[model samples]
Target: MDEYVQLLADLTEAGALGEEWRGAFERAPRSAFIPDTVWAPDDDAPTGYERVTKADAPDAWWSLVNTDGVVVTQVDDGRADGPGIATSSASMPSLVATMLRHLDVRDGHKVLDVGTGTGWTSALLCGRLGDDRVTTVEVDPAIAAEAALRLAAAGFAPERVVGDGLAGWSCAAPYDRIHSTAAVRRVPSAWIEQTRPGGIIVTPWGTPYANAGLLHLMVGRPGEPSHGRFVANVSFMWMRAQRPHAVVEPVGVSDHRGPSAMDPELALEDVNAAFAIGLRVPGVRYEHVWDDADPSGTYRMQLSDGAGSWASVRHTAWDAEDAVHQSGARRLWDEITSARLWWLEEGKPDLHRFGVTIALDGAQSVWLDDSGNPVA
Candidate 1:
């Protein structure tokens, strides 16, 4: 515990935490609000966690709370106790600080915080702007109850509402700053209507193919809507109401098999390829599969869309050629290859160089280099 406190202090000393936010983070220590039991995030783990509880492993729990990693609070939307899927968590300190930095908060400003989570963020805001100046909207009633209790216990009493975060807490309209913890596919109109002109809305935004990137909108006055470019690439869980429908494995119908066109290596090597494809391939989600245990010595990439379009490409380490198969109206592999080639033509711009604009009519346009040239 002593070491963790010094670690937090070190981050502030190193300028990772803003001067204005350092004191706030110190005042509302993350440890105070964390639950006794948390599922440690493990991407490689099939279940996604190895539970660490205070009562069972006090040292480990303390170490995790004080360290710089996520502490999962809920699994499968409050079900599947053994971590079938992590639904909610206390984000790593660095991510919290990064998003807060993007917020660029100031004193005496009214802030609306979406997705209360553990209420630690609200407590930090309360320490900076006073409790009356911060309002947090939470969707889960039980989580809200516990978080509100902890917030009050920590001597911070911010307005805590148990409602949909997408609604933007209408009672607190015209806020000076709006921050969303959840990732969004598009900027909600309520968030726009509730924020005053020139206000900042910071959130991680992603697409159906890939869930990564931050959307920083410096809203303009009425008749002008909001527009901004991504400042970083981040993968965050989707906002609950905005989550996409599940994509299942496609059953081969014999005719679904076909010949290969492009090398699977070409599409897989570039990291930002997924982000570039998401902008071009609407309503499509792709999954990559690697089986170390398979005796066939093969790996695969599968693509699917809501309209029953599906495709697969298989590669064998011992073989020279990769096999490709398509079954539906859309040649999913072809779409991926085309998108990758276009991205290359555009100089393979980084995700940060890409931008998005929400026009007055609610139409969203993605661009590269200049907002005038829409990508899709």
Candidate 2:
């Protein structure tokens, strides 16, 4: 009657835990892989979390672990003093199960698991196919060591490679399947190179403009470009190298000007619109901002990129005449609004309707209906 046991039962009833993956789920219960100290979302805060550890708060830690939400294990490469950027985490069970189901691996298939976070996925692979058929790679040396020790303690041992996952473990090339636990802005050609023809690759696809989803690609011949359709809408932290490296000089918000005819309210409600916008616009980052000056607590969609471009669309309500201001070389808000409008005109394709084709140059072209025409 332990809470974790009850959680397994609940996940099973809900169909999140497949029969094939159940044994792995039971044997490697996420609780075993997670660290004693973890960070969980703070209910009272908008974008903050409270740390819970077995030493100081065992009850809270257990409660949060079994509650089915992401647990931040390391923040800011383990250097941040407080709840900062979550560099590593024990992903929720449902999400893990979703990815595994999409992976569609079978017995005797050699799987290369990218992003050895907590080693839970590797352990699951071990439980199903045995340790011999699984190979895992971690980008962070410290994380690799910790995960290796955890996997060993859990009575599973897979080929552990301490190297950049983006390059892939070429030593074990021609893997029957590949699964990446990280969000990638660009599909790495090395991954396609390493995967065998007819093999499947499952990874999270991220856009710089603030949207992400699951990309399930079925590999063709070695020289053929890897292509696949997005299967789900989900968010993940960016891959290490894909993160912002260069610093952009600061900008005063007062410099931008103009009232936009485009309705800000229309942009905020459509998740599909946001995804389409990100597809058309590259390297753009956006956030929902609020100022106390507005009594209505209206949120402004703020957009910017490394090109010194910035735009903000504020509205007290969606149908109201919202104010928009833009500055710099690129007009981000105009690009986003135009993209959103185009999506509407095209009948609004969902995630599944969209697919990506990775050229030999490693450039990814996202298209709708088919790969004939790339999205703007």
Candidate 3:
């Protein structure tokens, strides 16, 4: 407990921690919510539940929860028997604090929390607004049940519903604030419909082409569309429905490829250029392939159906090759090149200045801001 307090104090000392959010962090003990059999990254080990075991050492687990970064708890539906990848998790303390600050919850405000992973965020909301004024929804039934128990144990139990959070809990309509811990490509209409006209809804929104960013929107009216601007950069697990199907490797492409002797700086520049292309043309798919045995590789970007583009930069600068295969309405590689050239001509501004505008239908467009206006 003392270590946890120190961690919170250190985070606050850094600009990342929010001052108003310390109370919630101090009150919630993350170890109480984490299951005994949690995934550990080392050796893919699954440590059994033991309240006083080394795995639960205050310095070890609490350090992870108290950081400003994310901590993955489950992956691939929690069926992972070992340390694999984290598909879901209790978001990091700093991010939680940031979101709470963005939420601006008041004493009596009704708040609806989406994606109650461990119910920790809901517990914090309940602490601020009272349990009766908070409601949280989780799609996974088992997770919801576990979160309910943890919240109850913390004495901040709120209404925990087991269902798709995409369909906002209408039973408690007209909430003063609607905040989602999940990343969603589409802003559901139900959220707009259930939030009060003046209420705020904040979520991470982006397509597979780019990392999601924080979107802050306000409910316009009961039947009207909500509008808002991108607030900050963030990344989150996609909503269950939005998760993509298994990616099929392109036919005639060998998984084994050789490493490129190309300059690391040049490779990074090209990768950044590809990202710029993705920004200009959303929904385009790309992959970078390299093998340890070889010094040659290819960067493939699929623009649209049947249009496969390949940019192969070999070990030698003079042997670099850019191939375009287009059988569609738009050539993706050309768009990428154009965007890259535009960036070069414009002095290559930082990517953080990019902004997004989300419409009522959940359609979002990223723009490069110039003098406070979207130029692209």
* lDDT (Cα) of model 1: 0.82
Top-down TM-score ranking: 1, 2, 3
Residue 122 error, candidate 1, Å: 1.4
Over all chains combined, what TM-score does candidate 3 have? Answer: 0.78
Write down the TM-score of every candidate: 0.92, 0.91, 0.78
* Tens digits of lDDT, candidate 1, 235-319: 7777899886566665655435555666666765554777887888887887777678983555777778878888778765312
Residue-level lDDT for 104 in candidate 1: 83
- Compared with the true structure, all predictions reach lDDT values of 0.82, 0.82, 0.66
Worst 10-residue lDDT window for candidate 1 reads 315-324
How many clashes does each candidate structure show, in the order listed?
0, 1, 6
lDDT of 2 by residue, 1-376 (tens): 2777887788889988889998998898887788888877677744376778898998888887887788888877877564466789888888898899888989999999999989999999999988988999999898899998899999999999988899989887779899999899888889888888889999999787645679999887756777798998878777899884332334554455666767776665566777787888788887776767873665677777877887777765443444767778888878877878888898887777888988767788888978897786
* 88-205 per-residue lDDT for model 3 (tens digits): 7877776777778878777788989999988888888876777899899999988888888888888887888889999999998889999999987678878887888878998877
The parts of candidate 1 lying over 4 Å away from their true place are: 41-46, 81-83, 252-256, 265-271, 290-296, 317-322
Worst 10 residues of 2 by lDDT: 245-254
